[model samples]
Target: MSRNVILYIAMSMDGYIARKNGDVDWLEGDGSEPDADIGYDEFYGSIDTVIMGRKTYDQILTFGEYPYKGTRGYVYTSEKRDNNEDVEFTDENVEDLIGKLKKEDGKDIWLIGGAGVIDEFIKKNLIDEYFISVIPCVLGGGIALFKDNNPEIKLKLLKTEAVNGIAMLHYAKR
Candidate 1:
């Protein structure tokens, strides 16, 4: 099967993935239900590899335990760091690296993010699909979804669903 690169992420209605300080407290749901994953398990199960930005990796470290242990994880970073047996850090060109990965056998690649990595992939036209969950609240000011001066890229809406106040918008490159 052809490998697909998917951008699966959640953001506020105002289009900010997290607060200006990289805080994602707004992403947590109120205790209306004790164990609501909102299709996360299904999405995670479908992807075999994950690529994320360095800042995103740092934030994940603060989450107590590493989350993508089961998946082939790569962190895009220019600086050298201690080798992680579970995750690989690379400074290689994004376009070249992703092109090589796509040709290999895999279920799908998950483009987990911070704005910089998302913008780079979009610029290189590497992303195949996007699954954005627009949370109900809006952040007045923070990191925008696509960075400033991004190239024009069109998308075809594949599907949409409203799950517990969150608008899950799925789209494919057009």
Candidate 2:
């Protein structure tokens, strides 16, 4: 089977992925009892490769340790950066990169995003699936999950589930 490029991410009810400052502290959700398994572990297990934007990677660095330690990671950027033991920084065209990745024998690829990267992937129709967790909050304004005037791409909802007040929506390109 061809490897799938999955856009797995969380967004606020109003459709913002993060605050204007790129802070996701709101994801904790009213300091209630810790969130239950929203199937993150299961989803993480299905992807061996991760693709993210430089801004997302930089934001992750502020958290100290790299969360995706063992997974093969590719940070998409226009700047020149040396590859580390954890990730390879590249400016390769999204379509060409994804085409090569899909041919490799491995688990699905995770399109971890920060808006710009997601937009590029969407433009090229490279993402095969979307796993979105809708958190319960509205940030009036911030970085949006979907930009205005994007190309219309229809999708089919495959599943929906609620866990700890968070709604998880799974979709496949139609």
Candidate 3:
């Protein structure tokens, strides 16, 4: 059976994943190489598909290297455009896209993104699990990591650890 959507992200105490302009240079330098790899590799290896928003896709593009291999990525957007043949950008309804993904034989789905994208998914109650690492630092305001409409989310904490002045929390929706 294919797994559902999983949100794997790193955030600050102030809830900003990056600066207002999408600059995460500080995060790039502060992360522990082994811990980062362990967390990322674990999530990526389990996910069969990844769904991201346009802004998140653009941010990843700026990095100049695609980390997605063997797994399919679908970018949800209201506008129509071409973003490489590898990435599929669709303006279709969210449920439709999710339904399509459910039919495919694969591992879990990854919900990688900026706040807006994550919010949409959270609001729709589509995210099944959230793997969050809280790093040290307060970026006051930028973009929130996870902002939902008081959706009554109950998280069953599965793991915890401190790496480089940070605390990682792995939770599944219950």
Kindly indicate the candidate among 2 and 3 with the higher lDDT. 2
The whole-model C-alpha lDDT of candidate 3 against the native structure comes to 0.78
Instruction: Assess each prediction's global lDDT (C-alpha) against the native.
Output: 0.88, 0.91, 0.78
lDDT of 1 by residue, 1-174 (tens): 889999999999989999999999898544455376588999888998999999999999999899888789889988898658668998789988888898899889999998999998988889999999998887898988877777777999999987677788999989
Candidate 1: Cα lDDT at 118:
91
Candidate 1 structure lDDT = 0.88
Per-model tally of clashing residue pairs: 0, 0, 0
Error of 3 at 10 (Å): 0.7
**TM-score for all predictions?**
0.94, 0.95, 0.88
Model 3 worst lDDT window (10 residues): 29-38
lDDT agreement of model 2 with the native: 0.91
**Model 1 pairs whose backbones collide:** none
Model 3 lDDT at residue 39:
59
Best by lDDT: 2
